[model samples]
Target: MPTVPRLACLLLVAVVAGCAGTDTSAPSASNEAETEYDAATVENMREGTYNDAFESSYEPLPATPTLIQDATIMTAAGEPLENGDLLMRGREVDTLGTDLPVPNGAQVVNGSGMYVTPGLIDSHSHLGVSATPQVGPHYDNNEVGMATPGLWMEHGVWPQGPGFARALAGGTTTALLLSGSGDLIEGRGFTAKLIPARTPQSMKFPDAPGTLKMACGENPKGGSGFPTTRMGTANGLRSTFLDAQDYRERWDAWLADPTGAPPERDLGMETLAQVLRGDMLVQVHCYRADDMTTIMEIAQEFAFDIRSFHHAVEAYKIRDRLAEADISASMWSNWWGFKMEAFDGIPENVPLVHAAGARAIVHSDDDLEIQRLHHEAAKALRAGREAGLDISRNEALRWITANPAWALGIQDRVGTLEPGKNADVVLWTGDPFSVYTKAQRVWMDGALVYDRTDPDRQPRSDFELGGPRQH
Candidate 1:
């Protein structure tokens, strides 16, 4: 059911905003006047001395202003608005309430009997790296060595893969596609906007903090290497952090006094140093409760923060401790007992963690699971309700949207349907909890990217032109 390639651009007015600057006063987009830079400054920029590159190149798909009326708007930040109107204008949400003044030439859609909510964000996914048509040639997720912190998952992503389109159709507007947990120190994971593009750079989320992928438990120990035992794995991790601490100190010394050339750049060591400086987010793959506790000890020893624990099936056992440490538990709704560490998983893992006052996130490491993240949350919500936890529908919705946004450190811009937030939204046919519901349309950055009714709007791959690709 793939649909279209990226269509031709349409001329539409967009209200742009200014990028966050270090200045005390935030400037607007209109105030971005061209400054005449000196020749020396231009030369420095050309030499890449000022800043890092690989910035976001995602532009809104060509679309006119859109207004939807008579729909239940799930703002996610607050209560749902019944029979409300949502206005998307110029790359931002204009307003969402009853009886809004529709701008001229705006396309008005009848959303009666439908529901609109903030676009879903998959906290964890492997759609792009381990793309569809799975085979030996397309496997780009895992690396050869155990320690690959310097490696970036985005570099290995195949943008033209059809999996992204299918994900978009399922209402996944954003995802943190990570490397598989085959290594101890996996790699740098990328938080990407799920838009079909020519390259990974075009899909990267702007200003998102870099994510460091580390793992504990069975997967790492199963490999035939130095870290084949739990003790060996823990010691190896501690040794890595100790080296990183020394690396951070040497860099600090060189920065304080530029006497000689800076210490020879160690890409892997530099990544670890950033973690030491609290610049990168540490997300670990640990299923067993004791392994998570060990990871917490390691974090304490190194003075780095653990943002979230991924695939932590046994997190419910230590929910209070996770809350005390302000760490999020990104777990699956029903995935249990696939391995030894994951054997203790329970159906109430998500809600129990949230009830204990910790950030509870539902993630999809599987491609098919990523397609219906809302339904996945519904499953957790039902289990919580059945167990007598007073969880609201909106609260359960946060598992996929807000909590994951917090985990990725992008909650300020997305995960909610606010006036100034990115207009990433999905139109659903019925209550999202209903198994019969389907995503009718999707928008990213206020651009119409997918429409179930229009073949020109739905995403299609070149490989789908002649025959079925997924089967």
Candidate 2:
């Protein structure tokens, strides 16, 4: 395996080469010097205007206008519709309503006794990085350093992972692949679409804001190190942010005038600076309520927002605080008591958060659970109803759809079945919350990526070919 520095150099080369189209030859001595000077100038540019060298190269698959008539639709943004008609025209939802006329040259599917919904989105996952048939070398979910924020999950993502196809078969259209919580500040996580591709860049979600995965509590405090205690954990995070602030200040001053020598670039601080500047979302892995409050206080001190807390088992205890802070709770339905910090988890955690007007999302942090996230949401809904909460099926559906999309900062593009949004639709054989139902057809950007009725349309990873579980 290549070292982190070597990987960064290769990524830079690829980005520069791709941007400067048709430049296949090496530059001469004078041209190389000029290129270095220009690179320095680009680096010192304004904060928000600085282009991401690793921007997504994803393009939706070609699709035609498709119409699914007479289905129960869960828009995830409003009440469920009965006998609704939805039309997908060229990667966008054209219309949705009762008895809508199908356009010319559109393929129509009879949806009698079926259900439709916006494709499920998992706010937390480790599919591509921690590839299936788990083994030592394939475990790319965590780095050796405890505070390596410079590392990006996209670098470790293997697009040929079989988990992508499993997720798509279970109706997951979009997912945020995160680093494990073994460290204080693990790395930058990335959002990806469940598209079978040869490279991670081809599966990246276009323009989705980057995510920084941080952690608190026992996971980070396990080893005998600097952050063996809760206080040490807090201090470590605070010190890192302070250092990033200084780095940002120095860069800003250098950008004011590019004539002089430029400051040395630190990859880790650059990522932290983006978080401080609100360009990237912060997703922390926190369990206990007190730890969650402490992290929120730290965020307040730094003036950076916490987007969501993963495995937030005790979030219900501070739902009001989370609501006020506008932090989302991405939690499991019934996972608890596996560790000391998770001992206080309750089945009604999501419901309590939702009742308090906080953003509540049902997330799957496990590889197998990610494929059945809809079922997890269904379990949470049942628990809430049994506890006397009047949560409807449509509202419960949002736990795995709109709520997770908002947490991933991609709600504007692919969360609801609204006109002009990406047509990421799932046709279910029955009510989505029902255990017996399966995703009959899954579409990403209006393209039919998975169809249970067609063996050829079902995607299979390269690893699965000629294996015992071949599709």
On TM-score, the leading prediction is 2
* TM-score (C-alpha, index-matched) for candidate 2: 0.89
Instruction: Please name the candidate that would achieve the greatest lDDT relative to the true structure.
Output: 2
- Candidate 1, residues 159-208, lDDT tens digits: the string is 87788888899898999989898888988889999987888988999878
Q: Rate the local accuracy (lDDT) of all candidates.
A: 0.86, 0.89
lDDT assessment of candidate 1: 0.86
In candidate 1, how many Å is residue 434 off? Answer: 0.7
Worst 10 residues of 1 by lDDT: 4-13
Candidate 2: which stretches are off by over 4 Å? 1-52, 467-471
Clashing pairs in 2: none
